[model samples]
Target: MPNYIETDYKTDPAFFRSYIKPDLWEDSNALYKEYMSWENNKFFVQVIKQFDKPLLRQIKNIWNYMGIRPKEWRCNFFRVLPGGNLPLHKDTMSKISVVIPLTNMTGELYFEDGTEVLYHNMTIINTQVPHGVKPPTEERIVFHMGIHDTYFEEVKIGHNS
Candidate 1:
């Protein structure tokens, strides 16, 4: 299978202003404990548990646009500081993953073959392969949604994990 497939789904600035803020990430310890296996403690992620009506509507619209009908899904709001970086890993609980950039900062997603990918608003990544993020020169915020993977297993860590 292909490592990743690009999608035409773009991000809505209005939705970013409405749902993706620092406050939404403040109270997500329970959700994080359940889903993510964050190996590097340097990165900060806020799991969005209680989505607002408008945000939910917008997410629904995105799902429709992607032509995906998922029974359940989860969103993680990530904040990577200038010097922080996440190690290479694959999604264990998510079948499909979509990352939406919420900030204008420069960052890069590097694949196993050492190829670097960058985008502004939205991008779709194949969580089944080994992928990692490089620290941007400035603060970076992104919206990550685990669309369809349901079987949560052990947390993987590092480039060889």
Candidate 2:
């Protein structure tokens, strides 16, 4: 199976960009400190969880439209600064992640098998495989949701089901 699959679900990137501010982003390593070391924290990505109810509702509606149910609480905005990169590694928490590029997304999502994907729309990524972001030319923001209960195969085949 492919490491990632593009989805038909699309959204206005500007809508998501309106919610982002440099000060609002928090280091992801702070929340996952147990999994990373201080030395490696510099390359860790940032995240924001200040989305309003309306935005959350919209995301849930998108999930419903795609026929997938992701953990609502796990959905948030992920940011990677120009010089920062998320190292290639397998996820220990979730098997599947729904990623939607929101703003200044110049990075490439690459996998261990040498496949790379650019964020042009909504995509389902297999977090169980070794994958990470290539350092972007500018700050990149993506709406990410960790789907623990669903497998990638189920999502890849059930888009309209």
Candidate 3:
């Protein structure tokens, strides 16, 4: 056992609740004061190191579970609330995003061609795969881990990206 298990949306629960103990990512935002200063143009980014230790442990767990050792990476968090939506977009980075949902989300994920992915236990999210979020919820918080494109699970080759 792994903490994250894969399953199709139709068979998963749509509504549920899970409490995520804070890893104090606030510091990674460069303290609360600094975050408030630039909360407009940017939400918060490039500050993943502020909370690196625990996050690294988590990354190791996910990597081991995926059976891949990443060479380079970046990781962060997305604190989205109800009604918060991410517009459809594509990532140009050479790295992939690994997301571990910290809370329950009722929002649906819209793929490039408009497919719905409303499932949970999201351990990995391929940035190359165009996607977006719709109808967010306050309870939806996700831990995002970035992995170099050089490393990835072979099983997810046909599924993720």
Candidate 4:
């Protein structure tokens, strides 16, 4: 389980650092209350399909790390329990996936990365490479997104490679 993380990625290092400190669950209810006000006064529960455009733009950064274009993008949140861990799994050895912990994050998500565990934020994860998460502290949460490279070439970030 500790032998399948892909280390060579191309995302802004700053993004990971910015996510170092987070705490959203405390205001989750309030956040939900005004969520509609966030994306045009529209109330969307159970998977907000199309979040604010800026978020979509941020997600584009994932393309650089994946080194591929995407066909589509989607996101979801997890109501994780204290010390709950997802089992090792693959989303297919070649597709690209992006996962970020919400502001309510408490623990860390570790990947095999073929050698040592690498914790990432706002970056691409090689789902086929095999990965999972480290049990987080109580009340921790996360957002996992899937992107299909092929239709995401135009989504660019200031990544020079």
* Model 2: per-residue Cα lDDT over 22-125, one tens digit each: 56666777665554455333343435556688788877777676577765336667777786777788887787887888875788999989998786788888
For model 4, residues 51-77, the per-residue Cα lDDT tens digits are 566555666555554455565656655
- lDDT rank, highest first? 2, 1, 3, 4
User: Which model is ahead, 2 or 3, in terms of lDDT?
Assistant: 2
Q: Comparing 2 and 3 by TM-score, which wins?
A: 2
Regions of model 2 farther than 4 Å from truth: 32-52, 71-73, 156-161
Report the error of model 3 at residue 75, Å.
1.1
Model 4 C-alpha RMSD vs. true structure (Å) is 10.4
> Whole-model lDDT, candidate 1?
0.66
- Deviation in angstroms for 70 in model 3? 1.2
**Per-model CA lDDT versus the true structure:** 0.66, 0.73, 0.51, 0.46
TM-score of each: 0.76, 0.79, 0.62, 0.50
2 or 4: which has the higher lDDT? 2
Residue 152 of model 4, lDDT score: 26
**Tens digit per residue, CA lDDT, model 1, 1-161:** 34544455566755665665555445333434433365444467777778788778878777666656577778877887787676676766777677787777577888788877776646667677777788888887888888764221211211111
- So what's the TM-score on candidate 2? 0.79
Model 1 bad stretches (over 4 Å): 21-41, 150-161
| Candidate 3 lDDT for residue 154 | 42
